[model samples]
Target: MSLVKKSLAKTASVVPSSTETHAPTAAIDVAQANAPVTENEQKEYPFFVAAIESDLAQLKTFTDIADKASYKSEALKRNDYLGYIKRYRLSGQNHHNTVLAWVFIWLVDLKRWDDVLELLPLMVEQKQPLPTVFNTKHWPAFVIDQLYDDANYYLSQSEQAGLFTISFVLHRLITTVKNQDWTGLEVVGGKLYAMAAKVDASLHNYGFAAAFAEQALAINEGAGVKGLLKDLQKLLKQSEPEQAVDAD
Candidate 1:
């Protein structure tokens, strides 16, 4: 599908199903539909479409309508991309997670971290997971508390998938440390240990020269790192820690 079409597809998922099945009054260009998809297509689809094609303009309107509709979960299940579709549509009764996930992906992709904070409260109102950025110093304590409240809510739903990249988590960790959120050091300490254990042990050969290590420890007095080591020590055989003892 075209980038615009695909994004519209996701956006359509959120629009109320009862709305007119056509484009809103907005004029869209047919020629733009023929534009190359090389740029947005090369990567995995972003959570939001950047521009709407003329043909798909009506679809965007439908999505806005769907966002306001009240639909039964069963009705939503009939759609192909149920998660995406249910996000913007339905009355306050919907509990879909797609909207929050898409919003996070969208904001992160746009590098609009501040705006993300603004949208986060709405997500919380809907009982969704908060983005992990607040776990670090990039945002204020009030923001972190709000984000953590949401994280705990989602964490109760399932053990975090543990699928986030160590680098992504570490980058945010530094932000938390920069903001003097000492508590973040402990929270991220476990994630670092988990990442180190899963990553190639060759990382130890580089010792602390690893980019993530430098970024995380730049502000920390190695205490956070030492805690990380202690966690890794529990997971590894004694000999591995012995070999790396000099590295510290």
Candidate 2:
């Protein structure tokens, strides 16, 4: 087998192993052993395994071509890389998962903002939960596997539901920070920001919107988000009683 194949087999084993070691801290984490690893758990293993295997192969091909081209930028100029970029860029539904984020990052590094914007959702969705990522030091299988998968549904429900989702996710984020597991927070907070933005926008809850937007900005201020600070200001002013009356 090739180096990539061997490396992945190694990663697969190590991920499960870490989960085994950290099974005691949280009850949710304890149950992670049965949380359906995949290969998330890959939406919980045969699927995870297959998806990961396929992704690794594609990644290897991308890198090999990138290296030979030298400019790195030069490779992206080619049809093969360009095609991959276009194929992965999800249009409206904008979501990101871990696997695609890695590729999307490279595109960003190349300063392809327009391309990145189109692909942003996928890159972002890649962080969402796309292909499960387990056992990486940054994201323990336990954390990824245990995060409430129903968070989106919660956000889609009433404000109360959205609040609960935020609390639930925020608590976990704090716990990881306490434990100094910065890596565990990967894409985890995005769930919070996305949920918060939806809830606030629906209610015109400027206070919460500003807060969540701040948090997201601290992490990253992509074009869609970089405006949160100023946007919130404008939104509040626009909603003021005087401004509303002025429309008449």
Candidate 3:
């Protein structure tokens, strides 16, 4: 067997082992669900397994190709990487799960947070299984699994749904900070804080954003959230005058 094959077999064993150790019942349940297939989902099952199994070789090619491209400007490089992936997809079947997993790892390694947010759902859905350490499978599995929690947490707390949450929040945060958008900052900040608190009052991200909000408000002194917050407050004031005033 090639190194890749040996590593995958090793990974398959370790992933289930860790799960069994940590959550025995859950692991058993998943193992049963993940049992060797019958005929159903037959068309896609092999594809899924093949894609998962191909991680190391695929990732090696991806890195070798991406490194030779460009890494100058973040935006330019982001666009280049995205374009390269798109071209790769066009060249063959749209094995989006594989692409999603690789692209997320690439973007995260690049510190291209904007790109990561944009591609996060695809990453989440790919649901790559964890691999052994220093192996191609390891990072994707960790990212997909951890983000499953992050996403579920985001949804249970969100008033809005789908395509809007991460994209909007990501853009809003970056924009607000970049332009010194005090009102925009407050508005997005408040919504995120409230939503996060609803999910887990103890969530560290929530605490950080809340503290930052307090600082932003202090910077303005008496202005209050001036941009989107102001508009939201106005809407709320008109809609629920009593509640709005009380909140203020």
Best by TM-score: 2
| Descending-TM-score candidate ranking | 2, 3, 1
Residue 102 lDDT (model 2): 42
Model 1 misplaced stretches (Cα beyond 4 Å): 1-209, 222-248
Higher-ranked by TM-score: 1 or 2: 2
List, residue by residue over 1-248, the lDDT tens digit for candidate 1.
43334554664533223344664342333333334443323221333334212322433455453342322222223222223322333222334454344444444433344545445445545555534544433223334343334344433454343223332333353344443434555444433433332231223423332333443454344424455445445545555777798788
* TM-score (all chains, Cα) for each model: 0.24, 0.31, 0.27
List model 3 lDDT by residue over 132-229, tens digit each. Answer: 34343433233333333554556666634432444344334334334333353443334333332233222323343344344445544433433433
Alpha-carbon local distance difference test for all models: 0.38, 0.44, 0.41
Stretches > 4 Å off in candidate 2: 1-135, 139-149, 157-194, 200-204, 227-231, 239-248
Window of ten residues with lowest summed lDDT in model 2? 14-23
Candidate 2 lDDT over 149-194, as tens digits, reads: 3444555565576555444454444333333323445355544454
Rank candidates, lDDT, best first: 2, 3, 1
Model 3 misplaced stretches (Cα beyond 4 Å) = 1-80, 89-100, 126-131, 134-195, 198-248
Maximum-lDDT candidate: 2
TM-score of 3: 0.27
